[model samples]
Target: MSTFGTLFRVTTYGESHCKSVGCIVDGVPPGMELTEADIQPQMTRRRPGQSALSTPRDEKDLVQIQSGTEYGVTLGTPIGMLVRNEDQRPKDYSEMDIYPRPSHADWTYLQKYGVKARSGGGRSSARETIGRVAAGAIAEKYLRLSHNIEIVAFVSSVGPIHLFDPEATPSSDPAFQSLLSTITREKVDSFLPVRCPDTVASGKMADLIAEYRDKKDSIGGTVTCVIRNVPAGLGEPCFDKIEAKLAHAMLSIPATKGFEVGSGFKGTEIPGSKHNDMFVPHPTKPLSLATATNYSGGIQGGITNGENIYFKVAFKSPATISIAQQTASYTGEPGTLEAKGRHDPSVVPRAIPIVEAMAALVVMDMVLQQQSREATREMLGRAARLVPELSRQEEKAAVEGVEKVLEAVEKA
Candidate 1:
């Protein structure tokens, strides 16, 4: 269950307060240039103690490539990586042995496994995401070099404050669409503490997080992610829609409460006529089509349509606050618990990279799966000829024919 993906599989190990936390990334394409340098940047971004907004755990998060590479090139074998735990303090979590912190994984993990880790939240800790970010870096490298795909995530909201007005429809707004197409990680990181791109909103969000931190509490927020240049037809239909896999990957992250793509729930308020994405000819590609609207989030009929894919992930406030709370123990005995640990008052800032990583994982896996399918289809040839393939000229003629018919109807 710890492993994810079908082709580009990743299995992560270790836990908070353990020796180290890392992951084994399998199915990297052979002979591509790879090293710790490519992976370390994201690890650094995801690491704790980066600024006053996050936990002061003081982890360098320096990743080391243990195997599956030679002379800085991946060897088509499982890539092993590790990051040592340097600043662990198991004694800080000694009180958690009896009372499971409210809304934390302690109680449920105990009920499921019968025995839980004596310190920290075990696998539920944000430290476990280091492996995901590392593995994602590798997948991202492959995608970037091969397809020029760009993935970026930024904090879009903190508590009730939003980067855009709550009533504004993001999918229909030209500014939001332009932001999705142009916003980069550099632009995102420049506004630290809160990664919102809007200068004014970022300031407000940071102050809100600081207010909660000073009160020894936590606040929740949302991160909006966009992926550009994803090739068309990269998802399975029925059970494994691209959006479904994306939702699954995102919700797996700790503290993530909800997931939505494109217009998301807002689409439900409009009728089908307004919500539908009308097809238009791609500006640069002769035979390809583009969407006039992206209410479907660049995916239609469960597959990507070569448009920018965007989504929002909602993260709950960190449950392990330093403030004292009245709660019950494993034995159901009432008591006061003052949780001790270094945790972010707001997680969306650091969660940006994690969101990007998970999105990379989902897209990479889907890409590989689609590639395999295409390769097999090519090798087998069209022996059955169930559906005849259309030539480029024929496709163009068909589009012109449709256009002429529509024009005649308009004239009538």
Candidate 2:
């Protein structure tokens, strides 16, 4: 499904090495402030060649808002966006046409569609995520301005260099809550090259990636994402759970292999008595609900429960490696292949923005769906307020013999 969401829907288009890449974002509320300025930073963040950790391909990825806005405000129309592709090197992937790279989508894409783009990994490339990041910026803008919700993602692990202690409380104390609420993208971007928040671990991760890059091999890593200020009842029940949708989004990214939330697989080690979240009165908002423990990752019964929603995304090693490997050709002849292309040694750092973007898309869609419910309740309340308890009209009708029955019935 190239298109995503129901109300705040977005459909991404174009391919890697194509003329342009972008998306059309639909269902933006009218009069909301929007512009390319609000969306470009994310695109830039997701761009490669920002540092030594990523590929050398540097596409400016400047987003151009083609339509659906006037004077820096949304018009409630389909917002058309575009980013032209520069720095194309089709020659870099010419060998891939005959000798399919191992563990890549090239073989599968051909098997499924009978043909595939031989340049720059095509639709299967990480470049495909540009559209997602662009649309996600728009969704994130609305979410932040209207609801005060915030999303942040950072490199959590690169080959077992964990930045966070798994057993430690994700929310340490009131100070942690304060920081969680106040943490900004600026702080995250401050940790460039390897988006890990811990300087020591980040340095180690950077070294490891450098070692891998020097060896012409790729390594896998993980990203941790957090959603803050998510209100209760944001997710649809049953199959379309918020966590499930989040899993879908994370897995949709190129080279992602696994996903987990909260305590994740480790939570199983604890007893039920120890793992269950205890409901308590909110610390700041009296009479409101909260949890003493967030083992549930702020979600229960597939709905958000007014707590921090956090999860981890596991990325697989990049399939294309410069290391010579024995592989079969498209014609079934055995051969040695030297994969040549500008690719990341690790995707975690660059994937941070992509993770943030996908989270924004999911949360924005869920928020819009929840907003419809809020609107319905408000409309019903207004209708009830405008009517008498016995269905009496406020004013009498002028028609003869055929009077308004509601007022007459109430008067009687």
Candidate 3:
């Protein structure tokens, strides 16, 4: 289905070469504040051609809110957002439309849909993610109000280069906030040919990307995302498990080659004795149960455990790099092709915000699910502080009622 989540439904539409692309967010609560400005920064981060490391295609990526609100605040209706495609260069892709780029969805889309758009890979392009990022930003705002959740993603790896310690912890940990403060689109672009985050590794990867660029080729990298302050009990169990939902949301992004949560693949190597998170109850904070180690990555039993939840998604480098390779035309004739288009040598940096956006979408969906259970005592337990003066009034009323019953028994 094009839409995601049962309550916080988001449906994205349009083609890469289409005049416009956008998303419709249904089920947004009324009175929440929203506007184009709230969603624009995310679009800017995901927009291509922002730096040398990203594709050279330039688009203003302006967002316009058409419906779902008046005067900035949500009207409790479906929220609709639009971003016009301004910097499309269809001519550069005219030839590949017939041949289909290797490792791309051109062939698969044709087989499934029977027809395909001849420009910019149409819906398959990363351009489609614009709607997702926009809609996700709204979800983020909703989450910040509902649960105080914050999501961030950064360049964790590029090619063989990674953010590693000179000893064991690395020079600086790749925390989302810390990494974002240091890197910008310009900084990333200046070193875009190689998507490395570490200066030492970036320098080496840069040389490698330039060398490959000279030879007309590309590479791949991985992005790591962290979800912080996600309230416990945000996930549903089993099939709609939080991790399952997160993977589903993330895998939909173009060129996303892999996904893993927490220790992920590494968990396989450790013995059960070493891998399990042992719960330790806090004294003063009786409500808190925490593990000294966070190998579970803040999730247990498919629900958030109020710990930092982190994951890594690997993206194959831009396939449209100017590489002369042997392939066949749509007619099955042998041919030599050199892809010509404005493209990133690597896309891991530009994809940072997209990763954060998807995580926000998932967490927000869970928060809404929790909100729907507000009446349950178990749910109420989580928000005891919200009752304010009503809690004291209830207690006083109970005491008075008890005394009246005792007086009636004595009179009898």
Tens-digit lDDT string for candidate 3 (1-412): 5788788889999888789999998988899888888889888878887755457788889999989999889998998899998887788887776588888778888999999888877888888888889989998888878777777666767677666532333211345335533454355545554444567777776665555556667777788777776777878988888998999988988889899887777677777797787888844467798776667777889988877787889998778767778899999998887887777677777787788788888887788888788658666686776687788999999999999999999999
What's the residue-level lDDT of 399 in candidate 1?
A: 96
lDDT of 1 by residue, 16-130 (tens): 9899999999999999999999999999999999888889998999999999999999999999999999999999998888799999999999889998888888999998999
Against the reference, the lDDT scores of all candidates come to: 0.93, 0.88, 0.78
- In candidate 3, which residue ranges exceed 4 Å CA deviation? 165-197, 205-207, 282-284, 376-412
Give the CA lDDT, 0 to 100, for residue 363 in model 1. 95
Q: Backbone collision count in every prediction?
A: 0, 0, 2
Evaluated against the true structure, the overall lDDT of model 1 is 0.93
lDDT of 2 by residue, 1-412 (tens): 6898888898998888999999999988899898899999999899989998899997999999999999999999999999999988889988887899999988999998999997978888988899999999999998989888999888878986777665655444354345455666788778888988767988999999999999999889998888998889989989989999999999999999999987788777778898898888888997898998787888998999999998889999899999999999999999999988799999889998899999999999999999999999999999888677435432333343356666788799
Error of 1 at 74 (Å): 0.6
True-structure Cα RMSD, model 3: 6.3
Tell me how far the alpha carbon of residue 183 in candidate 2 is from the true structure, in angstroms, after superposition: 4.0
When 2 and 3 are scored with TM-score, the better candidate is: 2
Deviation of model 1 at 17, angstroms: 0.6
Report clash pairs, candidate 1: none
